[model samples]
Target: MIFTGSLNAQGFEGWFNKYLLPSLTRASVLIMDNAPIHRKSAISQLVEHTEHQIVFLPKYSPDLNDIEHDFSALKRKRMYASSDTSLDDIIRDYCIT
Candidate 1:
């Protein structure tokens, strides 16, 4: 996994080169939401040079995104783990680790 202090275009580009590109076994279709960072021109150029193709999801369709479901399950588990803890506290605990 790639870790970074931010989630902007630069951070994503770094992750793509350092982690995603090297992990690929074959040309793949990458499905992504239409976030501005994913739409960056430099990111498109980078993808064009790689063996992967990106396909953006339709707008406002979280139900169609598998990662969204994973996050929802994780949120539920975290909430259950510390029902009495404040959200900020739980988030801080996670971020610090």
Candidate 2:
């Protein structure tokens, strides 16, 4: 899921169709932040056409986004982690079962 450059609407469209859509095991909610690319009319149309639902988080509401807490913890861990520690290890440590 890492891209070399900033994501534009077209790139997101391709990724959504090629990757995200195919990975769904069942109908689910795809919650996203209020990024411009995520707000595209085409993106909404694509999701609406599927059984899955898409929801955008309220603007400036990091407390409502669970990932924000994980990211904050990750940053704290990264700050103290040894140089030899791998990112995968850090993420695995913080991963919820």
Candidate that scores best on TM-score: 2
Give the Cα error of residue 87 in candidate 2, in Å.
30
What C-alpha lDDT values do all the predictions have? 0.75, 0.85
Per-residue lDDT value at 94 in model 2: 78
TM-score of each predicted structure versus truth: 0.50, 0.55
Give the per-residue lDDT of model 2 (tens digit) for 11-81.
Answer: 88889988998899999998888788875577778887789998877788789889999899999998899
Indicate the residue-level lDDT of 33 in model 2.
82
- The best candidate in terms of lDDT: 2
For residues 1-97, write the lDDT of model 1, one tens digit per residue.
6365769877777887778878999998888777777764666677888879877777887898888886786587586875688777766765576
**Alpha carbon lDDT at 19, candidate 1:** 85
Regions more than 4 Å wrong, model 2: 61-97
